[model samples]
Target: MEVLLAVDVRNELRRIGWISLQPNGSVSVGLNDRTFVSPDFKAKNFVWNAYNRVTIQYLISSDPKALKPIKNPHLTFHPPIKFQLRANGQHMLFEGIADLNIMLQQDGRVPWIRFVSKPVSELSKAGPSWNPDRTKILSIRLGNEDCSIGLGVDFVRKDVDVPTEDLLLSEFIDWQDYKLYVHSVAIPAQIATLSWYHQK
Candidate 1:
């Protein structure tokens, strides 16, 4: 299953001050409660433009080893999934689980599960560019999944001029010896912009 989630930037800005692009082309980003300053325009622009406008996508699946049929299961037991966005402190952007519904097939021997979420808007408010030297952290808790939780970080770099090398980071996590999951990938500007435009 695929889960799409968004960060509420308006609320996040309220909790943490807004990022700003200085007149001198410098960037000021508020993480936690402290401000970080940087001289990289591309990095700042990438984060500033993408911040709240970007939506996160997660690919979810059942643990292969734990997929045995159950004799009896609770039909209404939907699990809660929580996520946190933090720069320096906590930016409570989103917290909730996908709406899940289960139905029995006509054969009465099979079941189907459907997950849904309300549409999210793709609007960008005013903000400064992002600083490539700083990093932003996002953590997710998949409450009932075998892999209970995971962490993702947005790191910016300007040392490399090639666009392909701009977003270069990947990580994996192992859960209970049951799954080896790709935890995170650095977001590229092209992908981020596409994601923002895709949101309605």
Candidate 2:
């Protein structure tokens, strides 16, 4: 599917407290390292654009749905984005903004925006040919300008010891920091399971 990502510059300016564009108002969105035709090559690298704006495009075999709706939408991504799809031909993972829903108040101050991810069970059931390990899905939260809150899920492959990685809307997470901010959350196996257990 062809997707157009339109960002509200006005609101983002207030949140980050600066304009992303250069004095000439040019920004380049990088699509490096993010280009993934083969899943085995997961290169976590990106180039920066001095320009204030940028655009990126990529092709993927699968696209996941939003597991949850975003409540606050005052966030945007830094340019030169590389979108990569994991080796699983069935799953496509990108390193761009996980949450883009933002609202601008009349006063000009940018409020907290909300970002959400789709539940693993929903995505697995929605598309049968594409069986994704939803436990692999992660929700990462950014606070202030430096600190980050990582939320990990217990869903894992019993067979493979795939190292746990950090998920972010930004370009990439540093290898060292991944050890600190990462934490796990429970990913329900299925909606039916929740209903069945609640009844008891």
Candidate 3:
């Protein structure tokens, strides 16, 4: 399993010359070059209907989608392939979201969605007390009863549509260890273990 990174982003479309204050004191807004259209009514012949006299100002806006969209190369996600993590013993189910990344593999032009095997990099405000880790570390150590993990995963489904793709999220369970940056945490001479295996 591979750990992938996902970041949320938004693109701003509103710009200068797109909005202006008319001499009549009305706020005129529109897509600089696009014609305005809207779902509203109302017309009264001010010249003929003296009873309907009233003042009105207009502030036009467009639907979010109607505004031109910007492409984001960083976003390669599409309909998520399904995945489930089940731990050994008592059949406890581990749940997670696998922010799927749709990619074209070298094996063929066919698209594939990669599963996240670890918690996504931080931006989390849930605080340290919130344990959303979905990795095998915890699942593989339930009260010292001896453990292993079973994972079920599937590839991109044929009928999946791009308009409303199902997204997934993966969690962090445990790590044999994590690397330290800025400085070395250990050296070969200070090692205690001789071989690598899942942490006990």
lDDT per model, in order? 0.21, 0.22, 0.19
TM agreement with the true structure for every prediction: 0.19, 0.17, 0.14
lDDT of 1 by residue, 2-116 (tens): 1111133334311112233233322222221221212221111122221233333422222223332111111111121112222333232222222111111111111111111
* Candidate RMSDs in order: 22.7, 20.4, 27.2
State candidate 2's TM-score: 0.17
Candidate topping TM-score: 1
Please say which candidate is ahead in TM-score: 1 or 3.
1
User: Model 3 off-target regions past 4 Å?
Assistant: 1-11, 14-17, 22-26, 33-200
Residue 57 CA error for candidate 2 (Å)?
17
| lDDT per residue (tens digit) for residues 68-91 in model 3 | 321110111112322221212212
The candidate that wins on lDDT is 2
**Weakest 10 consecutive residues of candidate 1 by summed lDDT:** 191-200
Candidates 2 and 3 compared: the better one by lDDT is 2
Candidate 2 on 1-200: residue-level lDDT in tens?
A: 11111111222211111112223322212110111133342222244323332333332211224232211111123322222323223343334331111111111111111111233212211111122332122222322222212122111222223344443422211121121112322332321110000000
RMSD, candidate 3, Å: 27.2
Worst 10 residues of 3 by lDDT: 191-200
